[model samples]
Structure formats: C-alpha cells, structure tokens
Target chain A: MRMRFDKELEMLNGEIEKMGNLITTAIETSVKALVNQDMTLVRIVNALEMEIDEMEKTIEQHCMTLLVQQQPVASDLRLIEAALKLITDMERIGDNAEDIAEITKFFGNKTFINKLVHIPQMAEATISMVKRSVTAFVTKDKELALQVCYDDDIVDNLFLTVKNYLIDLIRQDVNNGEQAIDLLMIAKYFERIGDHAQNIAEWVIFAVTGEHMNTDNIGKTK
Target chain B: MRMRFDKELEMLNGEIEKMGNLITTAIETSVKALVNQDMTLVRIVNALEMEIDEMEKTIEQHCMTLLVQQQPVASDLRLIEAALKLITDMERIGDNAEDIAEITKFFGNKTFINKLVHIPQMAEATISMVKRSVTAFVTKDKELALQVCYDDDIVDNLFLTVKNYLIDLIRQDVNNGEQAIDLLMIAKYFERIGDHAQNIAEWVIFAVTGEHMNTDNIGKTK
Candidate 1:
C-alpha cells in the first residue's frame, strides 16, 4: 500500500510538471505572437490554453482522489495541497497568456508602436520564473523557488518602464493613445502572469518548508 | 461519526458564506469610492481587503484540516472541494476590489468621466452575482447557481457599453485619454470581478451536480 501511494505521488508530480511546461510554452508563444504580429502563434497559444485547462481539471481530480484514498498526513498532505494550489496558478497563467493573444489579434496588422523591447524581456523573465518555480516544486528546491520570487521584481520593473514609455508615446501624439493603451494592458497582463508565477513559487516554498511565503501585497500594482 | 461530519460540513458552509459577504461589501465600497471620489471609503475597502485575506487563509487551513481528519468521500468530498475553490475565487474578488480602489485612488479629485453610470451598474450586478452565487452554494440550489451564470451576461454587456463610451470620449478630445483609459480599466476590473463570481457559482453547481459549469471561454473579453 505504501509503495502504491508513493507511485501515485510520483504520478501527480509528473502531471504538474507537464502542465507547467504547457503553460510556459503558451506564455512564450503569446509574447512572440504579439511582437511579430503572428496570428498562427496566437492560435497556437489559444490551443495550448485549452489543453492547459484540461490538464488543470485532470490534476485537480487526481489530487482530490489522492487525498481521499490515501488520507495523506504530514508532508504528503502538504504536497497534495500545494499541487492543488499550483494548478490554479498555472491555469491563471494560461488565461493571462490567452488574454495577451486576444489583444494581439485586436492589434492585427497595426503599425509598430515603438520597438517591443522591454515587453519581450519582461515575458522572458516571467516564463523563466514559471519554469523554475515548477522545477523547484518537482525537485523540492527551496532556493530555486525563492529565486523565482526575486525575479518577479524584474518583471515588475519592466512593467513600470513599459507604462512610462507608453505614457510618453500617448503624450507626444494623441493618435498613439489607442495602441498605447492596448500595449499598456498587454504589459499589465504580463505583470499579472508574473505574479501568478510568483504565487506558484510561494506555494512551492510552502510545500517544502510548511510555511507560506509572505504574499500580503502580492497583486498590488505600482 | 456521520453526524460529526455533517456538523463540520455545516461549519464549512457557514465559513464560506461569511467570506462571501465580506467580499461583496468590499466590491460595493470600492465602486462607491470611485463614484463619489471618497478617500475614506477607499481606505475602508483596503482595510477590508486585509481582513478578507486573513479569512481566506484561515478558512483554507480549516478545509485542509477537515480533509485530513475526516477523509470525506463522495458528495461530502465534493462539498469540501467546492468550498476550497470558492474561497480562492472569493479572495480574488477581494483582490480585484482592492485593485479597483487602487485605481480609484489614482483618479482622485478628477473630473467626471461621462457620469459614471454603467460602471456603477456593473458593480451592482457583480455584487449581486457574488451574493447569490454563495447563496446558491449554501442552499445547494443548482437553479440559483445557473441564474448566477446567466446574470454574468448582464455584467458583460455593461462592460461593452462602458468601453464604447470611453472610446467615444477619447476620440472627441485627446486630452481625455488618460482618465478615459483609467475608467476603462476600472470597468474591466469590475467585469473581472463578475467573472470570478460566476466562477464561484459554477463551483456551486459542481458541488450540487458533479459537473463544472461550461466555463471554457470564461474571462475572455469580447
């Protein structure tokens, strides 16, 4: 029975890792789609989002079943709880990616609104945070999880840079206002995705140390 | 043992309902603050947000303990799972409200943005959805849950109205761009709050009927 429980636990870990990979791919694809104005990549991100949803529900059911069948205590319980929370964050990341894709579709064929430098950089940092945070969970690496939390600052700073740049663009020419607002919203979405990734990392920390990272002001924007 | 489980389930129900009320108040106050330009109410909304966060963590711990100690199965398992998911949505509602308050603070003492009609209406609809969705859960009323899902359409429609109005205002004069975008964002946040409430209602339906509401495209903007 103990062996069977251990095997099932291993399976749960595998499922979450798979979901994490799908989410990171979706985020990366969404940003690439926006920067390049590529509809095909946007479609792919949407498709990836649907798959992520299915994976989220599947992992959720699997975790519940484990809780019921095994009645896991101590670290086992924490692992299952963390898995449940992590998937929700993963699903939100997918949703935010889809949001970015939707906005990209809205901007279809529109002229470039300044070179998309900081936005892409922000997306890369957020995607890395997503990947490493999940790896921290799968490997029980607390340091990696903490590092993911720290990287959120980079995403946040880039968001401010994007905001200020867009504001300047809007001020210079009122015609740029619409696209500037759209770009600002896109940056905000990426920032939110970063927060969700940080939330996953916090849960990873919780799973490892039995203490939730201080997330009191987590979603607040500067 | 069965009676004890029933009692604990009732306690869980009560806890979630309480959280739901606090969330709705926060939503309402944030909107009122925005409409009236009242800093006092904004502060109140922020304070309520902190309490809502505390309640979320406490109830989450309680649910985890219930799961670990009782090992509830079948319908009871569904109830606990639904409650767990509900609080996450509820906590998000609080966060979104706090976000609205933050934006309201940003817009302090600003002049009128087209009389603030539909945004308030959207807030009202969202607060009702939040309240009724939780009531549906507490009563195990699938119809009410379905109704909450239907009501989301009203909020979505109001969002479009708000968006169009802001667009027209921005087009009329370039100087209105900043406040117009801010108002649009506030409307977007309320739309998001409504989505979160509808999500809670969907979980209610799931608890009662063992099927998640078809939320495949939920949170997608038109």
Candidate 2:
C-alpha cells in the first residue's frame, strides 16, 4: 500500500523539476548574452536570478517539511535528500550564469578575431548534462545518471581548450589582453556550471545506487 | 531508555567533527601552500581530498542505516539529516580550499602588488561562520546560527570592495590587467567559500529552529 505522503513527494519532485528547467533557461539566456553580445538579455538574466533564489528557498522548505513529516525510507528518502542537495548546485549554476553575463557586458563593440566556438559548445554540453541529470532524477535511472559523469569529461576538455585559446590569444597580442582574460573567466563560469551539473547527476545516481562519484571513479558506472 | 541508534548517530557526529577538523587542516595547508608557494603541501591537500570524499560516503551510509533501523522521530531524526547535509557542505568547502591552492600554483614568481585585504578577511569571516555554525549545530543554539547570517554581510562587503578594487586596478594600469584579473577570480573563489559557510550556518539554524531564515532579518542579527 502506498503511503499518504507519496503525493507530497511527487509534488516535491515536480517543484525540483521546475527549478531545473528555470536553471536551463538561465544558462541559455546567459550564454546567449555572452556569445551574441546581447546586453539586454544579460540584464534580464541578472534580474531573473532573484526569482530563482526565492524559488530555491521555497523548494528547500518543502523538502525539509517532507523530510520531517514523511520520514521516508530508502529511495524515497534519498530522493528528498538528492533534491535538497541538487538545489544548491542549480542555484550556484544560476549564479555562474549571471557571472558569465556580467563579464560579457565588459566588451563594448570589441571584435574578436574568431567566432566563439568552445564556449557555446561548453554551454550546449552543460545544458545536456542538466537536462539528462534531472531526467535521471525523474525516471530514477542510474544508467543515464552515470552517463552524465562521463559527459563532464567533455566539459573539462572544453575548459582546457578555452583556457589555451585565451592564453594563446593573450600571448600573441598583449593589447587584447583584458578582453581575452575576461573571456577566460567566462569560460570558467561555464565550466563551473558543468561541474555543478555533474554534482547533480552524482546525486541522482546516488539516489538510485547509493554510490558517490568523483574523478577517481570517472568510468565506474555500470 | 538508551537508544541503540543513538550510538550510531554519535559515531556519525564524530565522523563529521573529524571531517570538520580535516577541513581546518586543509584550509591551513592550502593557504600555507598559497602564501609560501609550497607545491608539496598543495599536493597533500589534493591527495587527502579522496579520504574526505570517502568519509562523506561512509557517514551518509551510516545516516541511512540509522534512519532505516531506528525510524527516528523529530529532533533526533533531524540530527541525522543534519549530519547528512553537513557532510556535503564540509566536502564542498574542502573542494574550494583545494581550488584556491590549485590556482595559486599557476603563478611563477610573478609579483602582485595589491594589498589583498579582502581575500584573507573574507576567509576569516567564513571560518568564523563555519565554526560558529557548527557550534550552533553541536549546541543547538539558534541565536548563534542566526549570527552567522549577519556575519555573511561582512564577507559580502569584502567581496564588493575587492571587486571595486580590481576594476580600479585594471582601469588604472593596462599592464597590471592580467594579474589583477587573476586575483579577482581568486577573490571570487574566496567569496564563494564564505557563501558556503553561510549556507552551512543557515542549515544549522533551520535544523534547530524549524524556521527558514528571512533575508530581511539577515542584517539585523542581535
């Protein structure tokens, strides 16, 4: 027989899923703000973060309430804990998105020699990780959650590429140094978002399999 | 009547307190490595992180065991859940310390002239927050935990000052742009650590008081 609190647990999951979607939107708007150099969208992402922060608080309280009232066992309990843990990652990702947007506003009509490649690639991969990780939560699929861990490697590689690109650009021409460094930091913010997404995926897998992940067990997924 | 799982919970707290000590050591070693340019110390911090990570896993499992075995109610159960959440924050603080050390290694005898008052000040405030927050946890003192929220403002002010300083430093000297920018990123990392500390304190408060802290009450801590 199902417990009465299952509906509240379901409600908690729905709220977390909504937070994930908002985070994805924030990342897209933020990265687009940078890649497309849209100051207007940058400001919008900035303003939108307060609402996300408020949502985080609300969802957190809900999770706490469920934990206290439901006294969930096994997977249900893990799901509540995972949702609680995942919110900080999502909130921090929203913050990194805002940081990237802020850095983008610094370049005023400055033309770069090349198109932004790795950054958008990084953003796309991050979005994929976020989407799939949350899906892993919704479906409780350990396999897909484990896959997101491997996906983080791609994000890490992109970070190295972006880092090297900025370093080479700065070394070649010292005059464009400021913008190049800012671009490097922007790359870092995106990479951090990927890290947070990996963290979420790890919690998803943990919720299902009772395992924790790090670089040591990169491909340890079954 | 003495509860059997209370012993398990005590062991869990012991592990958490041990991890807290490890973080204190990590913070010291990571900073020593940063200020003294000791690569060996940094490597030690990096290596010890695996142990901390494993400790988190083991403690989490222990929490799960207690929850499943005892089916604890209210405050006792809150303690276990609090331990579970505290471990994540503790581990992430370790990660942040490692990041600071890792970034410090990127510099090679390159001189930085900034007074850098804010980074260390921020670290101090954060350390205070972490200690006080955990003290609140151990003592179940809601007021002290609330004080940590107020202390977060000091760290935020330091971050803002550092940001303004970096902007002025970059605008004043084109040559100092790169190093100053790197310093800003480092400052950002420290500011984030402070944020995490504040987060831990908020958890401590919530676990005790059953009230989600109001940001409106954040500044007026008595």
Candidate 3:
C-alpha cells in the first residue's frame, strides 16, 4: 500500500511538471509572438493555454482521487494540497500569456514605439522564475524555491523600467498613447506572471516546510 | 462522527462568508476612494486587505484540518474542495481591491475625470457579483452562482466603456496621459475583481453540481 501511494505521488508530480512545461512554453511563445508580431505563434499560445486549462482539471481530479482513496498524512497531504493551489497559479500564468498574445494581435505590423528592450527581459525573468519554481517543487528544493521568491525582484524592476519607459513614450507624443497603453498592459501581464511564479514557489515552501511565507503581498502590484 | 463533520463544515462556511464580506467591503471602499479621492478610505481598504489575508490563512487552515480529521464523502468532499478553491478567488479579489486603492493614492485631489460615470457602475456590478457569489457558495444556490457568471459580462462591458473613454481622454490631451493610465488601471483592477467573483461562483457551482462549468476562460481578459 505504501509503495502504491508513493507511485501515485510520483505520477502526480510528473503531471504537475508537465503542466509547468506547458506554461513555460506558453509564456515563451507569447513573448516571441509579441516581439516578432508572429500571429502563428500567438495561435500556438492560445492552443497551449487551452491545453494548460485541461491539464489543470485533470491534475485536480487526480489529486482529489488520491485524497479520497489514500489516507495521505503529513508531507504527503501537504504535497497534494500544494499541488491543488499550484495548478491554479500555473493556469493563471497560461492565461496571462494568452492575454499577452491577445494584446499582441492588436499590434498589427507597425514598428514598436521603441526598442523592445525591457519587455523581453521581463519575459525572460518571469520564465526563469516559472521554470525554477516548478523545478523546486518537483525536487523539493526549498532553497531553490526561496531563490525563486527573491528573483521576483528582477521581474518587478524590469516591469517598473518598462512602465516608466512607456510613460515617457506617451508623454513624448500623443500618437504614442494607444500603443503605449498596450505595451504597459503587456508589461503588467508579465509582472503578474512573475507574481504567480512567486506564489508557486511559496507553495513549494509550504509543501516542504509546512509554513506559508509572506504570501499576503504575492499579487499586490506597486 | 457525521454530526461533528457537519458542525465543522458549518463553521467553515461561516468563515468563508466572513472572508467574502471583507472582500466586498474592500471593493466598495476602494472604489469609494477612487471616486471621492479619499485617502482615508484608501488606508481603510489597505487595513481591510490585511484582515482579508489573515482570514484566508485561517480559513485555509480550517479546511486542511477538516480534510485530515474527517472522512468526508461525495458532496461533503466536494464542498471542502470547493471551499479550498473559493478562498483563493476571495483573496485575489481583496488584492485587486487593494491594488485599486494603491492607484487611487496617486489621484491626489484631482478634479472630475469626466464625471466618473461608468467606473462607479463597474464597481457596483462587481460588488454585487462578489456578494452574490459568496451568498451562492454559503447557500449552495446554483442559480445565483450562474447569475454571477452572467453578471461578469456587465463588468466586462463597463470595462471596455471605461477603457475607450480613457483612451479618448488621452488622445484629447497629452496631460491626461498619466491620470488616464491610472484610471484605466483602476478599471482593469475592478474588472479583475469581477473575474475573481465569477471564479468563486463557478466553484460554488462545482460544489453543488460537480461540474466546473465554463471556467476554461475565467481570467482570459479580452
């Protein structure tokens, strides 16, 4: 019975990792679509988002079944509970990527208002945070999860830089107003992605240590 | 044993309702601060958010304990699981409200931004949605929960109206760029609050019917 439970736990972890990979790919493809104005990649992001949503439901069912069938205790229970919460955050990351793609559709073929510097950097930061948070969860690396939490600062700073730059662009010419607002929204989405990643990492900590860190300010944006 | 489980479930339901009330008040206060430029109200929103966060942790602990201590089956398990998920949406509604209040701090006694018509309307719609969603969860009213889902369209339409108005404001005067962006962010936050409320309502539906409904696109903003 113990061996069977362990096997099911491993399967659950594998499914979660698969979901994480889908989310990472979605974020990457969406950002690539935004920077290149690639509608094809945008379509891919949308498909990936649907897949992520399905995976969330599937994994949620798996967790529920495990809880009902097997009397998991202590760390096992923590892992299952954390998986439930983590999938919600993962699904949101996918949605955020899809939202970026949605906004990118409005960009058309026009040249960007400025060089695509900080937005791509912000994407990279969030992607790294997402990837590492999931890795920390699967490996139960509490230190790596802690690192993911601190790395949020990089994404937050990049978001601030992007915001101030777009604000300046809007101030420079009223013509830049619409595109600038769009860019600001995109940056905000990436910042939110970073927050979700941090939430996943914090959940990892909770799963491993039974302590939920300072999550009160997880999604609170500056 | 069954009686004990039901009693615990009732306690959990009461706590969730309390959390919902905090979220509702936060939304109302945040919007009031935005419309009135009331910094005192913003401070109040912040305090309410902290309280909401504490209640989330407390409720979460309650849910986890109930899961471990009781052998809930069928609808009982569904209700517990749904409660676990509903608190997340409630917490996010609180965060979004606080975020709206955060932006309101920058408004700083500015004069009428074109009479603030649709924004207050959006706030009203979302507050109603939040209230009804929570009541739906507590009372297990699937019809009311479904109504909350349909009401999201009202908030979404109001958001578009507010977005278009702010864009026009920015186009008309470059000076309106900063405040217009801030106002747009506030509207987006309310829109997000509506999304979270819809999520809670959907979870209530799931608790009642075991069907997740059309949540595949819950947070997918257009």
TM-score of chain A in every predicted structure? 0.96, 0.93, 0.96
Model 2, span B1-222: residue lDDT tens: 246666776677678777777776777677667666688988988876767788777887787666655667777767776777777888888888888877777864556657556777767777777777767777778788778777877877787688667656755665565566667677767777767777777777767766556443467433
Stretches of candidate 2 exceeding 4 Å from the true structure: A3-13, A35-77, A101-117, A167-182, A215-222, B1-15, B62-83, B104-122, B153-184, B214-222
* Candidate 3 lDDT, B1-222, residue by residue in tens: 888888898998899989988988999999899888999999999999989989998998788777666757789989999998989989999889999988888778878657888889999999999999999999999999988998898898898889878888877887787778888888888888888988999999999999879853444455
The sequence of per-residue lDDT tens digits that candidate 3 reaches over residues A1-222 is 999999998999899999999999999999999999999999999999999999999998898788777868889999999998999999999999999999998897889989899999999999999999999999999999988888888888887788778778877888888889889899999999998999999999999999979753444455
How well is each residue in A60-126 modelled by candidate 2, as lDDT tens digits? 7687666655667777878877887888788888888888887778774578646899989999999
Decreasing DockQ order of the candidates: 3, 1, 2
Off by over 4 Å in 3: A215-222, B110-114, B215-222
**Among all candidates shown, the one with the greatest lDDT:** 3
Give each prediction's root-mean-square deviation over alpha carbons: 2.5, 4.7, 2.7
C-alpha displacement of B120 in model 3, angstroms?
Answer: 1.6
What digit string (tens of lDDT, one per residue) describes model 1 on residues B76-124?
Answer: 8898998887888899899899999998898889787578889999998
Clashing pairs in 2: none
Model 1: residues with Cα > 4 Å off, grouped in runs: A216-222, B112-114, B216-222
**1 versus 3: better lDDT goes to:** 3
Better of 1 and 2 by DockQ: 1
TM-score to true structure, per model? 0.93, 0.78, 0.93
Best-fitting candidate, scored by DockQ: 3
